[model samples]
Target: MTDDRCFRIDEMDLDELRDRTRDQTLIDAFSNWIRNFAPHVDEVIAEISAAFANNKLRDGIGLFEATGLDDYASDEELRRLRASDEKLDWKRISTADLSRCYCSPSFFDPQGFVFHLPAFLIAELNDEHPYGFIDRIYRTEEHPEGWRALLTNKQRVAIIAVLELIREHPDYQHELDDIDASLERFRGAQSMG
Candidate 1:
């Protein structure tokens, strides 16, 4: 395998991954992956921008908020939406498990695959630094998969933080909590593959 295709299992750290995957290369990869899966972020921005141009910013925000997407809109974006004439630099929020920005799954993949942001995230965290779970005692019959094992407290927290950021609507908070609780049953597998 090419070196780029290879990763050191020895260099893994959960704390680092939990806070933010310390590997920029991996982060960039995740950034691409997340953006690929969630195109609506941009779409929402476009709609908001169009509304502002039409001098209907308030109506636009209210309309989008009804769609349950206003929370993900950045403060600057919201401000700009309200103040259409204000010259402000509004940065788009990049979200998802891979990106440092916490995000919940807006929906599942069309192929009916379960969204595995936490799984992919833990796997990436394992690849990024040493002292990761792969080399630790968690591997065994309880976690024969080496990389996979029962979710640790830290892992749950990390995953939950990601979920808190991404949501279909603010009201879906309870559903996300339920999903997180359900995920507690799995081993910490290294990769989605």
Candidate 2:
């Protein structure tokens, strides 16, 4: 018998990310956003390199910061990120490694955020527990005051799509207030573009 029951986005298998399953519209939106923003591996790498060169990585405690012995990321997680950048494959990152990016939105400058954004989007659509992903959307004040302004129109639109996705998800009903607040801010930003 066919498994006709609907599944939550976070409950699907990783391979099903593009399988036209439940939440396909959100998946396609995220995929299109990734393709539009991070179309080239070289460009992505260049952005990451610029962030590193410009000291744009953020000043707050990152997901990996102060990990005396209990590190949030693997010792090789950074290397894996570099590898993924070279390959343009978000799936190369393990869930734990993806958490490092999603959990610490303040750790990335605007450019760095752009670089890792696809991963955040993918994790949001797939990970069972995407820690801090929701906060990343609504905790706009945690980032530099000018951060939102630095994002390109396409990037802002991508964020808007994700916000809407979360706002409509039943699991996120409790976060409606914060999601609505962020939606307004982002929509306002979009209009100014």
Candidate 3:
């Protein structure tokens, strides 16, 4: 006996057809799309986050070396670094700059990493926020440090998501072009200073 009855489709309205057609074939197609596309987007984000983290580490190391400060440098030393009279090249400094001088476990925490970033650099990052929360938090004076902490967390998450996308779809690597453009803009601003 033939199984032709399994393939029969009665006439139906658009909505009815859509409802009835939600079968294994449709479900499998949706699943395939997610499997194929989601990862590429995620990979891009993760790579970006890793890049940012690496950059932070580099900045912290540079700071320690330039200042000749030990990891246990006193708060006085840190204050002096932040002071205008120190003539510190804030623009050229980064989280890595601080790492060389400090051995604190908190220093490596990605969320606390923002503390190593100069206020101005943080401002730039906020300026590029795809969401308004970064700008809003940065602008508010109620709790500057807290705001930075929040932003650091938010950025880390966003970058990780992008990395996941990149990982999923190597073919869509070009999706990083926009991120590159944004980075170029930031770099240009730095050069101008």
**Alpha-carbon TM-score of each model against the true structure:** 0.18, 0.51, 0.25
By lDDT, the candidates rank as 2, 3, 1
**Comparing candidate 2 with candidate 3, which one achieves the higher lDDT?**
2
Q: How displaced is residue 66 in candidate 1, in Å?
A: 24
The prediction achieving the highest TM-score against the true structure is 2
List runs of model 2 lying over 4 Å from the truth.
1-96, 100-104
- So what's the TM-score on candidate 2? 0.51
Residue-wise lDDT of candidate 2 within 122-177, one digit each (tens)? 55454433465545757646463556676666666766766665565445567888
Q: Candidate 2's error at 76, in angstroms?
A: 16
lDDT minimum window of 10 residues, candidate 2? 1-10
Candidate 1 vs candidate 2, TM-score winner: 2
- Candidate 3 to truth, TM: 0.25
Query: What is the C-alpha lDDT profile of model 3 across 5-103, one tens digit per residue?
Result: 111112222234346566665444334434565334334434444444433332232333224343555777755653421123333543343333333
Can you give the lDDT of residue 157 in candidate 2? 70
lDDT accuracy of residue 18 in candidate 1:
31
Once superposed on the true structure, which residue ranges of model 1 sit more than 4 Å away at CA?
1-37, 56-193
The true-versus-predicted C-alpha distance at residue 130 of model 2, in Å, is 2.9
